[model samples]
Target chain A: MTVLINSETRVVVQGITGREGSFHTKTMLNYGTKIVAGVTPGKGGSIVEGVPVYDSVKEALRRHPEIDTSIVFVPARYASEAVYEAIEAGLNLVVIITEGIPVHESMKFTRYAKLNNTVIVGPNCPGVISPGESKVGIMPGQVFSKGRVGIVSRSGTLTYEIAYAMTKAGIGQSTSIGIGGDPVLGTTFIDALEMFREDDGTDAVVLIGEIGGDMEERAARYIIEERYEKPVVAYIAGRTAPPGKRMGHAGAIISMGVGDAASKIKMLREAGVDVAELPSQIPGLLKKVLKK
Target chain B: MKLYEYEARNLFREQGIPVPEFRVVSTAEEALKAAEEIGGRLVVKAQVLVAGRGKAGGVKLAENPEEAYRYAKQMLGSEIKGELVKKVLISKAVDIDRELYLSIIVDRSIGAPVILSSPEGGVDIEELARSKPEKILKIFVDPVVGIREYHAREAARFLDLDEQTLKKAQQIVIDLYKVFEKYSCELAEINPLALTPEGSLVAIDAKIILDDNALYKYPEFSGEYVRDLSYYEAEAKKMNFSYVELDGNIGILCNGAGLTMATMDSVYILGGKPANFLDIGGGARADLVERAVSLLLKHPRTEVLFINILGGITRCDEVARGIVEAIKKTGVAKKMVVRLKGTNEEEGRRILEENGIYVLEEMDEAARKAVQLGGAI
Candidate 1:
């Protein structure tokens, strides 16, 4: 009943022999993510956490044809190639957890993924989690519980912070996705919103956006134009950030007076979305919207 | 990384795109010699990374070598848009029959490279796009297909080019796309693509911003460009930490970029200003966290240190150990508020508690405590 993944979603791990890849592979396994195979060039024929490792995605697919999803943990320089490999092998959904990927490479691969009818979650993101059933990302699994509220954000630990608060307040989540903090992302706020809209398990949505680019503005336009049915609660970070300064994320900059918190907040509020002033206020806002 | 105008000009010239003849000089005497050698009406331009250099009096037209020297003297070492002008470019001023605008930039909305052109050039493109949207011609180019001849021809037609100028302008557009692709630039622009009296198309100015993520492919650019970095900011860059200095009292440090920014925003919402935004990044060990904490403690404006760690990949215990080590090493004795949750939270809380640093479970509570302790309204 989850949006993108569930107990039946078999997975393959790309770059599973590396430090982050190996570490998170174990953690994802611990979260019951049904990881069927691992792919690492030259490190094939090995095993990581009782999962079979293949030299390439094609090889992994041949042995495990049930694997329909892939999670990439490759380094930035080679991450794009790994994504291309996953797409070429016909993986329906690829979740990229690598950070610092070149935007140009991401642009080409994301377009390629689209043409091939594949979905990409992030290049510099913390994957995805559907709570209780299965978790495909590197997020803290303990913070999330199965519920009807779907969470999508452009942040990592920040999503966890809010999700943890919601869980403590007896507000569980159906799925949570970090769409990444890069200037160019594979899955944007609009894309995630469409997915959440169609999911029967998700009764409400919480969008976590920050300053940078016009994605938030565009999402607001989409929400209004489509007359979105779900009661959406939102929280945008970096309200006090200065102009022309990158607030940690490469995409989180207020440039040329565009993509500031004030403008984003204004646009979202106009779209009839309840915007939280603080991260702690999100649970209360969701409760208000759910009540209505 | 944004390249200097002179550097962009050099790249354009290398790619066979025509640009005005120029010499980059740091001294006024060198500028005078270069101007005399060119022997025509020249433009003296201060080399800075900031926008609106012309409005800041950093760009001046000189009638003779003496005037060029005076302009260079006035511009060199002068501040423009808060950036010091360390070099001046003396170039021959062209007799322009018409001015045009052309650029290839990665459009985030389309998720592809886009070509933007306007017949009315040498003006603010953003302002123009806002006020007169119809004046700008946008052509989206697929990265897979690249800049086709038809795309260039379409741009040339949009600009109302003549029969002779059409071919030349189209070629220049295609060449500019090649440079953009080759260099992995976020933006490669020729602000005023001038058509001279001789019917020659020349790039009057060049602006290129290379993707920071793609810098690894171009190692020759290392340490060549000047970044507007403060002392602590530069230090953070060396350690591979994302840090931005702000004018506030509470020093904010956290794990992820969004979390760090959220921490800063939380402090702001509670009426506290953050001194700096520092993200130690994911999976940071104890030593790296110690270094980040020390960097914040050394800042003069940091009166209270707010450490918020929502551990996912980053371990809470490691962060707590680093904070404890930093305080002991620096001995600054500033007011501190620590929030540690997730991934060995009990151990991290115990370590902080043993060091007299009580930890809060909630981020808002921690931010409020730090703001109150710092006495920052």
Candidate 2:
């Protein structure tokens, strides 16, 4: 079975009245995702891009009980509230596309969501996509296609860049998820790697990471400890990023000794995963692993 | 953001932790009056955020109000660790029986909050943790259960205080934990939880770094912008954009954070040094691009401007137009290297070319062009 979502997965859009919410709503629909309902605080009983809008997640769930996944497009302040509402409504997967969320707020909700057994893809991240079958995030649709490789990353644009490079090199993906680049996030590299390990559609893995966080190093330890035999290719950015300054993402900083790219690459290579020197070099490395 | 010592004292005072009588003053005359009001022996401290203020001659003890004024006059307008001293905190100096250390920090490794305490204090904890590991006590607090009285007792016990001192120290531990939790601080610490000669505890110096993300809920957080930022930094802050100035010649602008860093790496790899790291963020419009370009060109060291736009969600044409508009408005003839890819590349290239600005097809070539144009400027 495919991981996360398939073509039959019913979806709800939070903050559907907002510009990003409405735009991505159309983008997802165009990519053949099942858009069942929409939710905004005050804009109920209306339709957004031919999809019904409700005042709250509760109302949306009541109207459409088939809804299992929610894509959040709310702003930073109300993002946690939206996630809480979705968790309360019993949705299994919630993908947040909002940026600039506070670390404490993110920590509270991520901890809360984990306790409830709900899967959250991002708070300040691009959401997930299962190629050909279903698309649930705001990643450009033209760059992806249905295939056998499983992909996971902390970066958004670089995810698209590498995936495009892979597609150009005749490699395609089964699933690609952005776990967000925040300091504290709901999902980690290991979580996605574990999912890819179990999924029958995925034969190998490509982990895209950047400077910051011990998640990549921890994932390497998990790989070696579990002795998972699937081929994994990794690409980590920010090789020239300075120490102690945040480079865009809340989580992408080199502070207090961990999360540098050089150390991450060394660890990944030691774990038997092929680590690429550049984003453009990933596909060739992946091809070599697949041939072996 | 880190709170000044005097500001941190106020927070400690509110949490029921005892602080020595103090006044925060901006001028030398005000420092004299504050010294007089506090009476007794006075400690004149330069209120800069940097550490090792004592070694930097930022901290001093005064025998009289005139001496206090003299110290404040010398410290103010002086540079401490490259940051200007804007305010001084004058506190009644306490005669210490012993110096002890206590701190509650957000430990990312434990995935929860933790407290560190030591019988030996007034020294850097990092150095202590390195040189004398066993002297420090570490206790991790569970998030769901919250910090408990037992946790505080454990920390006090580890510090090896007597029964008489243990009860009061435990209360202070709990109070510190409360400040850490309530303020959404990454760290809440008192380096020297001074043991006064008269059988009382006082937080002589303290530091609290609030989580920037959680600052939204703390509406008063805006009033805490006390740091002296560089010219472009303040302008960028006012515009609600992320801009960092560096000592280099090539100015850069990119949409996403990862892409921006990658661009910088490319610049450095191709022998170009980026003057600043400017991220317009994802989905930026034409006007934002214009502002970003103008700001980059405004820097005196900038020899060439590099704009790398991978327009996935953001349209490429808008970026191209922003470059043209910015150059036309600012009239800054600094050389620019442009790379426009992803969505609508052809039309974006057309827009730039029509405006007499050339767009490169490859990021590598564009970076090379920028470096060659800069030529070690």
Candidate 3:
């Protein structure tokens, strides 16, 4: 009943021998994710942290037909090709944790994933997690609790902060996904919202958004048009963020009002979603919305 | 990274795209010499990254070499749109029969490289798109297939060019696409692809924004393709921390993009302004945290240092070690508000508390403390 990943999900690690790949592989393993195989392109016939490493995603898939999900920690330049390999190998979901990928490369793989109907979590984002079931990506597992809230965001550390706040407030989450902060992303807000809407276990949703891109605006409109009945609580990150300033690797060049947090908050408010003024206010807002 | 006009011109010339015969000069005397060597009425254009330089008097037409020198002197060491005109490009001013606009940039809406062309160019393209949408023709080129001949032909036809000019324009469009890809540019634009009275198409002005992500692969752009960084920015660069200066009193040190921005917003919402934004990117150990905290304290306006660390891959205990080390090294007796949660939270809080640093468990409480300590000005 959980979306994207669960205990039944078998996994493979692309770039599993890399510093980041090998590091998160052990983390995912400790989180109780079924790490069945690893893909390192040329480093086959090897193993990382007791998991078999194949030379290619195809070979790994052959050895473990049950592997349905993959975590990609490939270097930024080679990230797109790795995602394509995962998609071509027929992995149902590909979670990319690498940051600073060129927008062009991100577009190519995201489009490929789309045309093939394979779900992608992020190229510059933290991956998704279903607490108490299975964990993927790099969010600290201790901060997440199994419940009805479906959390999605465009940030990594930010996701951890909110997830921690929720956990501290005794709120449990069904699934929390970081869709990435890049202007061109694999999964959009509407896409994640739709997935949560269909998942029977997700009773409410917490959307953590930031300034930059029109994804949040579009998501708000979609909520109104679809009349999504879930008690969605939203928290936008960059109210004082200067426009077009490169905040970080995840910084956005907001050309106009289209990408501003103000417009997004307005749209979400008009859509009848409870928008929290601060990240710390999110838990209370969600409780208020759920109680109503 | 914005390429200067002179650099873009050089790139165009190297690509065999027709550009006006030009020479770059740093001084008025050199400008006069170059203008005299060209032996014609010249254009004196300031070599800077900012836009609206033309209207800002950074661009001028000189009837003679002496006039070119006068213009250069007026421009060099002068500020246009907040960018100093360090160099001037002097070129033989061509007689224009027409002007056209062409640009190729990655468009998010299309999810591919897009070609935007307009016959009535040399003006603000955004305004043009807003007012006369019909004047602009946008073509979304397939990323895999790239800029095919037919896509260029489609763009040329949209510009209403004659058969011969259409062919020439088409080739130029294709060449521009190559430049975009070769240099890893996010945007390559020809503001006025001027058609001269001699029936020759020339790129009089060019703009290229090299993709920032691609900078690692193209290290040459550090001095060539970009402007000089501010003092703090350059220092922060060496420290491996993402720091941007702002006009405020509270200095923010945090991990993760979302958390840092949330901290900034929290400060503003609580009636405090952040002096700078610093993200010791995920997995920052003690040294980085110490270095970052020291950097934040270096700013004169920074009165209250707010440390917000939410541990995911970034351990709170490591951040605390950095904070304690920074306090020791910098000997900063200023007020600091620390919010540490997630992994190793208890250890991190204890480390800060043992060092006489004030710590708050809640973000709201930490922000309130920061604002209260920061006070007015």
Candidate 4:
């Protein structure tokens, strides 16, 4: 079974009335996601694309109690409250796409979700899009097709580029999850890698990392410890990032001296994962790994 | 996102943590008044954003009001780093018997906040960690459980602190954890948690870097960590552009900091001088691109404008639109060369073509075009 998501997954949108939430809801709907209901406090009576918008997650659940998964699209300030509300409603698979949710808020929600036995995808991520299984959040649906390659990335836009590159090179994704670029994110590369390793449909994996943070090194050790049989391709961004500048994401700072791209690339290479220098070379590298 | 020493100390005071008595003064008259109010030899420290004030001759001991005024007069408006010192912190200098280093930072390795303590203090911890790592003791706190009493005790005992001093150090560490979590701080450090002659531990210096995303919740807590830029400057900063006003002859624009810096270096590297380093990150929208270009062209010395964006999130087509929009909006006649890449490459090329603009994809080609245009000017 694929990890975290499946065909039976029922997902609801938290900030379903906002511009980003509304636009991405339509996209996710087009990808055949089992989007059940929408949540917005003041815009409860209104409907988006015929989906009923409830005043709260509890109200949404009263009409559709079968809702088990949730996708948050609220603003950064209110993202924590939205996540807590969804978890309180007994939803399991939570995916938060809000970019700037505070780390403290995230810690609280992640702590609660962990206590309640719920799997939270992202507070800053681009959400998970499983080809032909289920789709959630804002990934381009047209670019992805059902296939064997699994992807886990720190950066959102970079994931799209790599997925596009892979598709153009005749490779498709089993599931692509953007684990977020924040320093204190819920899920790391290791969690996603373990999922991909256990996933029967996933034949290969592509891990996209960035400079700053030691998540890549931890994943490298996990691969070596578990001795994953499937071929893996890895690429870490920000090789040319100015030494001390905190690039886009809050977590991209090289504070601990462990998350540098060169060191990560070295560790990944040592763990038998083929590393790609350029995004364009991902497909060629994946093809070579698949031949093994 | 990091607060100066005075700002962090104020935050510590608010959180019920003991900090040295201090007052912020912007002028020498105010500094002298503050020193008189404190009624003792005050430490007049230049309040710049960067650290190492002690090493930079920014921190001075003043025995009287005149000395304090003199120190403040000399330090204020003087450049400590690249930043000009606009304010000074005057605090009652503590009689110190010994100094210790205590800092609480989010350790990503364990996915939890960790407390770092060193008995050998008053120096750079990074340098200490390099020279004598054994003196530094680390205590990790579980995110769920938080910093336990035992955790504090271990840090205290590991640092070889005295029983009474250990209790104060323990409470200080606990209070730091509270501040770290309560404010969503990425880092809260007391560089020299000084043990005064009175046998009390006082936070002589403090540094806090509140999580940027958490700034909304901590608005009331906002004091001086903010970079003190104007509204437009702050917006430009949020957009990830490196903007510096320079006295030059050509306006240079490029994407990627490394590329932008190298572009300026190339302009200098090739004997053709550049005006400024303008880096519009890889994700600039049309509005941002237009704004950036317009801002660069605002300089009187900007005779020629060069726009370079290696689009990944910021597509070439959008950059082209931005350039066209800027031309329509501000009518910048500084002869410009635009370099664009990534998705919609052809679209960007066609847009620039239709608008009668010179577009190039290579950095050298774009730089050469700018040089040729500047030479013509």
List DockQ, one per candidate, in order: 0.83, 0.54, 0.65, 0.21
The Cα error of candidate 4 at residue B340, in Å, is: 8.1
- Residues A1-292, candidate 3, lDDT per residue (tens digit)? 6899999999999899998889899999999999999988889998899999998899888878999998899898888888999999888999998888877677778888888889998878889899999998888899889998999898888787788888889899999999987777888889999999999999899998888777888888999999998988898887788766767655455663347789989999998888998887888887887787
- For candidate 1 chain B, the 10 contiguous residues with the lowest summed lDDT are B220-229
> Residue-wise lDDT of candidate 2 within B263-339, one digit each (tens)?
78778877778888888888878898888888887788888898888878888988988888988999998888998
lDDT of each residue in B73-92, candidate 4, tens digit only: 99998998667999999998
lDDT for position A196 in model 4: 89
RMSD after Cα superposition, model 4: 4.9
Residue B43 of model 2 has an lDDT of: 94
Give all candidate RMSDs, comma-separated. Answer: 1.2, 2.3, 2.0, 4.9
Residue-wise C-alpha lDDT for candidate 4, range A1-292, written one tens digit per residue: 4567768888889999998788778877877888889999998989997788999999999999889888998988788888889888888778988877776667666777888887888877778988888888676666677788999987665676668768778898888988776777767788898888889988899998887878899999999999988888987776645455565566776663456677898999999998875565788999988887
Candidate 1 wrongly placed segments (more than 4 Å): none
lDDT by residue (B235-303, candidate 1, tens digit) is 999999999989889999999999999999989888888999999989899999999999988999999
Better structure of 2 and 4 per lDDT: 2
Identify the CAPRI category of the predicted complex in candidate 1: high
Q: How far is candidate 2 from the true structure (C-alpha RMSD, Å)?
A: 2.3
Instruction: Rank candidates by DockQ, best first.
Output: 1, 3, 2, 4
Per-residue accuracy of model 1 over A216-287 as CA lDDT, tens digit each: 999999999999999999999998999988888878888766889989999999999999988989999999
Clashes of 4: 0
